[model samples]
Every structure is written in structure tokens, then in C-alpha cells.
Target: MKTSLYNIFSWIRFTFLFVAVLMIWALRTLNWIWMRPNRLEKCLRKQGLNGNSYRLTIGVTKESAMIIKEAASKPITFSHDISARVLPSVHNAIKRYGKNCFMWIGTAPRIHITDPTLAKDVFSKYDDFQKYYKTNNPLVKLFIGGVISYEGKKWAKHRSIMNPAFHLDRLKHMLPAFHSSCSDMIRKWEKMVPEMESFELDVWPQFEALTADVISRTAFGSSYGQGTNIFELLKEQSHLTLQAMDSAIYIPGSRFLPTKWNKRMKEIHEQVQASIRSMVNARVEEMMDGGETNEDLLGVLLRYNLKETQQNGVGMTVDDVIAESKLFYFAGQETTSGLLTWTMIVLSKHHEWQDRAREEIFQVFGDRKPDYEGLSRLKIVTMIINEVLRLYPPVVELTRIVREETKLGELTIPAGVSIMVPTILIHNDHEIWGEDACEFNPERFSEGVSKATKGQVTFFPFGWGPRICIAQNFALLEVKMALALILPRFCFDLSPSYAHAPYVVITLQPQFGAHLTIHKIKH
Candidate 1:
């Protein structure tokens, strides 16, 4: 009877302890989702910032999605003013709450910053305002994570090692690969065009192919065939990622659930990593056996990595190499292809600019293959490319998060509030770009990007400050080469079937297609 009474007492004690722990967990979660957000909202209000009232766990995300969906349902008429259609929710928010406002992206408040000064502050102080993880969805990292995702010392180390690969001398060595890819693409286009007449075709996919091929050749060199396979997988992965994001707001730990999107994303990531890992291993083996290092991106990176390891006793691992290489493929293909696509569309609209660009191209190259020296000399072509970038930047906006309280000019930004620097909005700002900000005037960039922005942080198509896109020069060179080759070969104008719809999937791309009639030049 004594033993039975002791056992009952122990069981009762254990039950109470379990319930106490459960209640504590529930209270903390409630504080995180409710109490903390309300506190942040009140704090922002005290500072005179305006925004919609926070709504439960979803916040304004659902409302924003609905607006975006409604805006994307139909294409706006042909005009350079695309800010509304592209970012309807943000645009609406700005209109309603003015510039000095914040919006809830889930529980976190994302403050819109149009002021160039504050944008500069956020960008320059990379450590304070870190790279924003767009969503809490852990699976999103599978597609977008890489060197760009790292912060502080890790970012510095990766940047230092990769810097040599994009040096002017190294880029010049990759010129042959660029020319070869462009030539192949042009040859295919010529085949598509009839002997002495015009043939209508979609140039969007053509540019995508051209850029993909260029990246493959420049990045992988002799192993370009395999690189092509990786590019395709990445393309599909991007689409799946967008779908997953559009489907729902991420619940923490939901990535582990056996969902279809989750499964496919994991599978694609594994495949890409496996393919890249195999290539990296092969190259490392070659180096270990005292084989000569090729000047391709992978080879150059490995060479530098080895040097770093030998000197500092540590370097990037195979996984690190894989991540960087994956970045090269995605960034290289997307940025250039988007630029080239928009260039063609813009040039077609402004025939006079096209004539002048062709005149300049002829003056520089004149029925010969474009050399780097000749490419640099084509000033008119450079201006046109710059104008296109301003009007249709590959990336629409940049987001950064502050982990701790940070001061930006007069405002004191609390920890966990995100900063939204809308690149598209800044690029088209009347105050910054003048009255003709929305117009496609290449003449504005005649004195170069620095002169055009008047030494402000306004024009950052490739981004701004230290953490700018590393391959901006590489992308620009490729564009110059492509435009040089195509201008002397054909005259292009938009086909009647074409629709003027530009939307962002991964980058700003045509909603319909870039259907243009290509008239083969009779030389």
C-alpha cells in the first residue's frame, strides 16, 4: 500500500510538469506573432511613419498578393511607365501612406526608402543592413542561396578569392568563348531567316538561349555540354520556386512536410549539386595530378582557391565551389539575357537610335568580328545599353534587414524592420532623373552613369557600393559583343502579333513574347 501511493504521486507530478512546459511554449509563440509586432507598429507610429494596421499572422501579405494578381491579370498599354503594373501593391502603399511609411511583410515591418541618401546609407553599411532573406521559407534557399547569401567574414573571404576571376585580363581571355557563342547563335538565326526576305520570330527565347550558351562556354569551357543540362534544371527550379512562394506564406518547419513542391525542389537541388560536384571533383583531380589549369571560370577559381589554401591553410570546400559555380550560371544568364531582350525591344521602338547605333557599330567593326578594343570604342552602343538598363533593370528592388537598432539620417530603425530600396522607382524618379525620367533617352547617359546620376546613389542597375554584382563588367562586355555582331547582320522591328507586356518571373521578361520581324541584311 505504501509503494502504490508513492507511484500515484510521481505520475501526478510528471503530468503537471508536462502541462507547464507546453503553456510556456504557447505563450512565447503568441508573444512572437502578436505582442512583438504590435509593439513594433506602435514604435513606428510614434516616429510618425504611416502604414496599414497589422493583421494577425498573415499581416498585409495576402492583400499585397491580391493586388499583384489583379495588376498582372492584364497588361498595361505600351509605355515606359511600368512601375504600377510591376509593383502594384507597393505602389499603392506609397500612394496611400506617402514615402515615409512602412508595410508589414508578415510580422516584420518593411519601410520604403526612396531617398537616395538613406539608400546609400543602407547599401554602404553592408554589415549593419544585411542581405534580406525574402521569405522565412527555408526551401527558398535551395534555389537562391550561395555566396550572395553569406555575410561578414565569410562574404569577404569568398569575394577575395573570386575577385581575380573577373579581373580585366581574365575577362579578355573569356572573349573567344563569347564570340563563339554569339557566332553560333547568329548562324542559327541566319538559317531561320529566308534568303532575301523578312521572317518573323520570337527573340526572347533566342536571347535566353544565347545567354545560356555564353554562360556555359565562358563558365565551364570544354564541359559546356554538361553545363547546358544544369542551366535547364535551374530554369525549371526558378519556376517551381516562384510557384511555391505564390502558393502560401511559409510556416516555420513546414519545409520538412512531404508536399509535392517541397519534394521537387529538394530533388532539383540535389541534381544540380551532384552535377556541379562531379565537375568540381574532376577539375580538382586534374589539378592534383599536375595538369595545366584552364582559364575558364571553374579552373581560375580552383587555382586561386588552391593558392589560398596553401597560404592560409584553408580555402573554399567542394560545396563552396559548387555554390559559386551555380551562382555564375544563374546571374550570368539572367542579367545579360534580360538586358539584351529589353535592348532589342527598345531599339525597335526608337528606330533613329537603332540607325545611330548601327552607324557606330559599322564605324568600329565594319564587316569584321568585334574585338575587345573595338567594343570599348563603341560609345553609342554603350549609351543605348545603359538606357535600357535604367528603363528595365533585371532586378526591380533590393531588400535589406537590420538585425539591431540602426540610425539612418534622422530616423532610428528598430531591429527586425526591413528596408526596401525600390531600384525601379529610384531609376524613374522625377526628382533624380528629371522630367523625362520615363522616356527612353540614351542621350541622358552620353557622359556615362556617374555623370547622369550626378554622383548620387540613384542609378544602380547592377546594384550599389561594395556589395554590387561582381559580374557587372562581364555582363556588359557580353552585351556589347552581341549587339556588335547582330546590328551589321540584320534589321529588326516588332512583329504585329507582339504584345507589350513586361512582367517579373525571375527577371523582367515579356509576358507574351518578343516577336520581331528579322530582315536579313544584303551585304
Candidate 2:
């Protein structure tokens, strides 16, 4: 009788476990479907926000894809006014619905925040929001691998070790490196010019080379010359990644499926890794030889990581060092170059500001090479660069995914919803900057960006808060140094061949190239 009772109890326990497993599976499937369309609409509606009704499982995916396709098909223009060009869909949605509205991007509801106060709130709670959107292409992951992809504890650890490398004092020490790189550019341009006549030239490549040189000198020190081929391969990889990104469907294991592009990308990645590893190995060997210290960024990073590793008995591995070095190589090269290219394009259109900036550069340095102190004193130049960043930000958009149920403003964002903050839209919002928001007016920055945004977090070319670009100062100093040298020595105007096609790969870049007419300034 006791054995019979035990058997019955065991059967009951088995049935209960089976029912719980079934319930969990059912809930997960329902969550995936509802989370995209139904739940997103309900959450927005609860907050008095209106937008297109989510359509079943597809949500807004079709509409978002259509917009991207259309943008890609159009011919590139030379206008720096991206807000005017790119705002039709977003503005139409806002016009149809209220200011606070949601739009669909591939079964994901994108909530648009035009209110400065609300934008501030979103940026303030950055940690709660992460950049892991559902549709992130695997190719993109391969290209932009580093601290940018990390969140929470991992992000904290990487950021802590990397922060000291970009401090202002270190950037100041790197000013000569910035100047040397710019001087190489100026010399190259000087050799290219035939007589005093204005000649049309593509400035994009020049900017690219300048930034590459700066990154090489500043980040790797003596190791840069050896790593040139690695930079070239990385640039090729960037182009391939963009091509992969344009395709919609990504099957499982597609990146390693032995396709032509995949093979090429793999080869490029390996070459870059090998180059970085060689440099790192050399540095380690040098450290072993009599403890001679190298003060460059790479050396500083290696030493710091080594010391930390020794103390903690575990820190960033050699592979970590290689990953980060590649990241710096690409990110540092692309960002500053893009910034300078756009700034040059904008300045060419506004020659008065160009002359004014030149005058300021002259007053600050007077034909002498720009130093850290002199670069800071050029407030007008700073304003011009800041204004250019607002109009043609290098990073046009930033995405954040909700890891948990989080409250943003009055809305409860369910986990897995990706929030995209379009920097261009926010920077050029008429409500925030008044009627002249779209115009390139450096005077807006006269009272400083804080006052300009009325204490809201509106202008974020380098982002805001803790996760802001680590190399903001480095990029700025490089720009100031380059402009201070170039503007005084040459007068430039937009080339007729210039096509103003700004698009995003890893960073926002000219789809064609920045063509400008350059005439040497008579000293």
C-alpha cells in the first residue's frame, strides 16, 4: 500500500513539471510576438503618444525598409542640411500624430523625443538604455568591435582602463603629433598645386590620410609605419561591411559561409590582428629590455594594462590589447577625418565665416605652429567646429536597447525595444534652437553649448554622459590644429563636382568625396 502511494505521488510530480515547462514555452512565444507590435502600441498609447498602429508581427518593418531603400537610390546632393533632406518621414509622422510619437522599424517601435527636457531624461538614464537593436547585422558587429558594443560591468572595466589614455594632458602632449600630420597634408597639397590658380581637388582622401597619420603617430608611436598596411586592410573591410549591411537577409553562419566577401573580410580581419599582435609582441619585448618607457598611447595602454593585470592577477589579455588597438585605429581615423571634411565643406559655403575663422587663427598663432594653449584660445574656431558638428555630425544616430522593463518619462519600455536617438534631428530641431536652427551660425555657440541648448542635452556630436566618445578631446585638438594650419595657408571654396551625399557606414561620411577648389594664400 505504501509503495503504491509513492508511485502515485511520483506521477503527480512529473505531470506538474511538464505543465510548467509547457507554460513557459507558450509565454515566451507570445511575448516575442506581442512585444513587437501590440505591447509597444499599448505602452505608447498609455503615455498619450500617437503613431502608426503596429501591424501584427511585421510592425513598422516594411515602412522603415522602404524609407532606407529610397534614401539609398537617390542621387547624392551637396547640401549640409541633412535635417531638411532626411526629416520628411519623421516629420510627417509627427504631423499626423502628436509630437511624442512612435514609429516602426522592423517590428520595433522607435519612440521619437523632440522635447529637450525629455531628451535630457533619456540621455540621463543612458545605462538603462543600451545599443543592441534586434536587427544589428553581424558584419557591423565585426567592424565595430570594442567598448562601443559593451555594456554594464564589461563596459565599466574597459572604460576604466582606457580613460587615462585620452586625458587632456595626454592630448596636449599629442598636439605635435597632430601638427606633424597636418603639416604633411599641407605639404602634399602645396606640391600638387600648379601656380597660384585655384584647382579642384578631392579633400576627402586628404582628410583620410591626415587622420590616419595622426592615429598612427599618436596611438602607435614608432609602430605606426609598420602598421600602414593594416590600416589599408581595415579601410577595405569597412567598405565590405557596408556592402553586407545593405543586404536585408542574413542567414545563420552567413559571415563564415565561404562567400567571396566573407573570405575577403576574414582575411582582412586576420591581417589586422596579425599586425597588431606583432606590434604588441615587440612592445612586450622592449619592456623586458632594461625597462625603457614609451610615452605614446599604445605604450601607455600596455603598461597600464600590465600593471593592472599584475595587481589583480588577471586583466585585459593580449587579445584584448589587439582588439582595442584595432578599434582605436579605425575609430580614431574615421571620426576626426569625417569631422574635418564636413567642417571644410560647410566653411567653403560660408566664406565670411571662413575668413573670420582664418583671422582668428592668425590672431591666435600668427604663422607659428598651433600649440595646445593657442588652440584653446581660438574660441571662434571652436564655435565654427561646434556648429559644423551640429549640422553634419560624424555620428548621425545612436541606438539603445532596453535590457529590462524600464520607465522612460511616463512610458514603460518593455525589454528588447530599440530606441534610436537621431542626432541630426535633435541637433537641428527648430523648437530647441529657434528659427535659425538649420542655419550654420557659429554665434549660437558664443555663450557656449549649455546656454545654447537652454541646459538640455540637445547637441551630442560626441554623445553625452559617461559613455561619451573617449577621444573627444583628441578629435577636437586634431581638428583645431589642422584648421589652424590649413585655413591660414590656403583659401578654399566648394568644387562644382562636389556631391553632398552624407551617409553612415561606421561613421557618417561623404558618399562621393568632398571636392573643393584650393588656392594657396600669399604669405
Candidate 3:
């Protein structure tokens, strides 16, 4: 009996020892992955590029997190030269390692490509340098999780199916929706300033709501009033997401824990997906019933997707359609809002240019509804929008990763390394844009981007190459329509309470809120 007990104890001991050995091996493997410099990173260094050394798993994440927190704690003085404030980590890296340097975003060694030629190459070779699996936050996939997230044949198929929806004719058909939404906002403003003189209000949230309203109508065939619940939920989700991503607040594995925020984020995502599914299901039923339906974005997308499935036996699944709809809700609204806000803020600062824009608007539309032709003719407005996009773009950066060893220019980028196309930095570079690059000068874009860059591929606010934003034309048209109507109705100036602190969450925004004093324009 004693011998039997001893044998059993020995077996238990053996099992524990084996487990310990396995754990140590797994840890060593993980450490290797976390700290080992890839061939691409080595190659980059050999080619004279510089960066921070790789550390286990975290890399420069802790350092960047601390720096970003510190920067966000205090607002910089009123100015647009906010590269330092907006991306403290990137700015510090540039200051330390020069403009051409690498930085670590988690495990990925992100080479900062400031050269326009290199930038162009990165965008052009979309297949070679694939987008990182957007599950960066996991739930972020719900919002920007459509065609922008696809690659190879999947991307080709999705883009082909959705192209007709945003074609000039389709977008032009949606102009009345844009006008109606813009007019609704104008009416609200008219009521606020009932005396018909002037009023001081924070136009930031106003524009946010206005853009959200426009997107709701165009994207879902529902007005802002009708889609208020979805928009509210989205707003909540976004705030929660930003809070979760906050460098100062983030904790690994916390998202998996039953924390309030994690639970809430999951709940919101579920609700959003369910809402989208219901909308799509109802639309599909109506289409199946042969009932005429409003030709909004969802309607167009469904129609095309169904036609494809019937003809070719391949098309977007219901979930896929839901993803595209959610993408439209977020991207369609977020960017145009930023554009309008910054344009107004800048125009308010440069009253003369505002007058010029107003004069141009009058010259083209002249107390009439803005048509596509008139919007196209507003060269000055276009220039201002481009300059704003340069100075304060919606997305501050773009990133691509080398999944396998690939030669770009003189260097071979090894797999597992990501590269950053610092759009804001490239846009603000004096080397690319001359001495006045940082200055807000719409005149630089007078002859357009090609002429402005002297035929070099420099200005890429909507991005460059085939992977450029699909919704850019749609966003710009909405901006022009809203601005054309608003410019004639009111002339605004920055309120004394206005503090220009441009910061980035997901997109560039006026940190202090865009407070503008509005003066009703007299006929």
C-alpha cells in the first residue's frame, strides 16, 4: 500500500514538472516574438533610418501612452500648429530620430514614411502592404468594418458592387436630401436668432448634429429625428471607445473582464448590429414584395448586392450589408462634420476669406439652391476645404503593414513590420509645401493639388491611389451644399470664448469646442 502511494505521488510530481517546463517554453517564445527585431526593421536601420529599440511586447507603448496623457492634460495656446499637441509621441519621435524614423505601436515597428514618393508607393501597392486587421479594438470593426477593411478579391468584389451608389449621378440624386437637412439646421438657427441680428453659440455640436442628420437621411432613408436613437447609441459607443483607448486608462485584458465599460461597449455593438439587421431585413422584405422604396444608400446597396447574388452567386451577406451601413453612419458623418467645423473656424479667423467665399457662393448660386454645376464652380470654396483638410484632416494618420518580405524603393521591408503614412505631418511639411506649409493659405491650392505640389504627389487628405476614400466625393458635395446655404444666411466670427485647441480622438476636432459668434446676413 505504501509503495502504491509513493508511485502515485511520483506521477503527480512528474506532471507538475512537465507543466512548468511547458509554461517556460511558451513564455520564452512569446518574449522572442515581442522583442526580436524583424528583418524589415534591421533592413530599415541598415538603410540609415532610426527608431527606438524594441522592448518586450509593449515596445514604446508605455512611453507613448505617458507622453500622450501629459500632452492632453493641458491645452496649447490658440493656434493651428498643433502637430506637437495632437500627436505628442510622433512629434517626439520626429524630434529625436528625425522625420524619417520608426516607432513602436504595440508589437509592430511602424516606420514613419514622410517622403511623398514612399507614401505614394505605400498607397499604390495596397495588396503588398495590407491594412492591419482592424480588430485593433475589436469592436471598432463594427463601425469602419466594411470595404475599407477588405483586401484582394474581397475588396475588388465589394468595391465593384458599391461603386454605382456613389457615382456622380447617384450622389447628385441625393442632393435634395442634403439640402433638406441643411435647411432644417438653418431653420433651427433662424429660430435661435429670432431678432435677425446676431447670436453666440457653439457651432461645433450644431455642425456635428447637422452632419449626423444629413448622413441619417442619406444613409438610412430616415431623418435625424427618426434616427435619433441610433445616433445617440453611436455617440455613447464612440465615447466609451475613446475612453477605453485612452492611453492613461487602458488596461490589458480589462476588456474581457466584466467591467462596466466592456459590458456597455458589447451591449452597444449588439444593439447597433441588431438595429442594422432589422433595417436591412425590412428593406429586403419590401424589395422582395416588389414595393417601390426610397433609393437611399442602404436601398442602393441592397439592390446591388441582391442583383449580384442572383446573377453571379456571390454577394454581400446580411452581416456584410450591416457592416457597410454602420461604416456609412460613422465615416459619412464624422468627416464632413470635421470639415465644416474647421472650415468655419478658419474662415472666422480669416474674415476676408470668408467674405471671398460668401461672394463666390453668391456669384455661383445667388440666393438659389446650389446645383452640382454651381458647387463644382466654387473654386475658392474647394481651395479652402483642401487647405483645411491639409491643416486638420479627419484622420490624422494612415497605416499599412508588410505581411511578407517586400522590396519598396531601395530597402526590403520584412514581414510583421507596419509603416505609418503620417498624413498630418506630410501635409504640414515645409519641404513638400514650401515655407508657408504650416500657414493657412488656401491660395496655395488655387491651381489645384497637382500644380500646388509642382506635379509631385503631396497633398492626400482623402488619401492617394486606389484605396483612397470611396466616400470622398459624397462628403465633399455635402460640405459644399451645407456651406453654400450657411454662408448666405450668416457670417460668423470666433467667439471670445473660443479656444482653438485641435486634438485627435479618432479624427481631428476642436478640443475646446468650435464656438463661433453668428451674425445674420442682411439682404
Question: Which candidate should be chosen as best, given TM-score against the real structure?
Answer: 1
TM-score of 1: 0.97
Q: Write the per-residue lDDT of candidate 2 for residues 329-393, one digit (tens) a residue.
A: 99898999999999898989999999999999889889577888899999999999999999888
Candidate 3, residue 88: how far the Cα is off, in Å: 1.6
Model 2, C-alpha of 352: deviation from truth (Å): 0.7
Tell me how far candidate 1 lies from the true structure as C-alpha RMSD in angstroms: 1.5
Q: Rate the local accuracy (lDDT) of all candidates.
A: 0.88, 0.80, 0.83
Task: Estimate TM-scores for all models.
Answer: 0.97, 0.89, 0.93
Q: lDDT per residue, candidate 1, 56-133, as tens digits?
A: 877478778888888888867778889898877778788899875888887778899989999999899999999986
List runs of model 1 lying over 4 Å from the truth.
Answer: 1-8, 246-248
Off by over 4 Å in 2: 1-36, 56-62, 75-78, 84-92, 133-139, 223-225, 243-250
Clashes of each: 0, 5, 1
The pairs that clash in candidate 3 are 40-414
1 or 2: which has the higher TM-score? Answer: 1
Give the higher-lDDT candidate: 1 or 3: 1
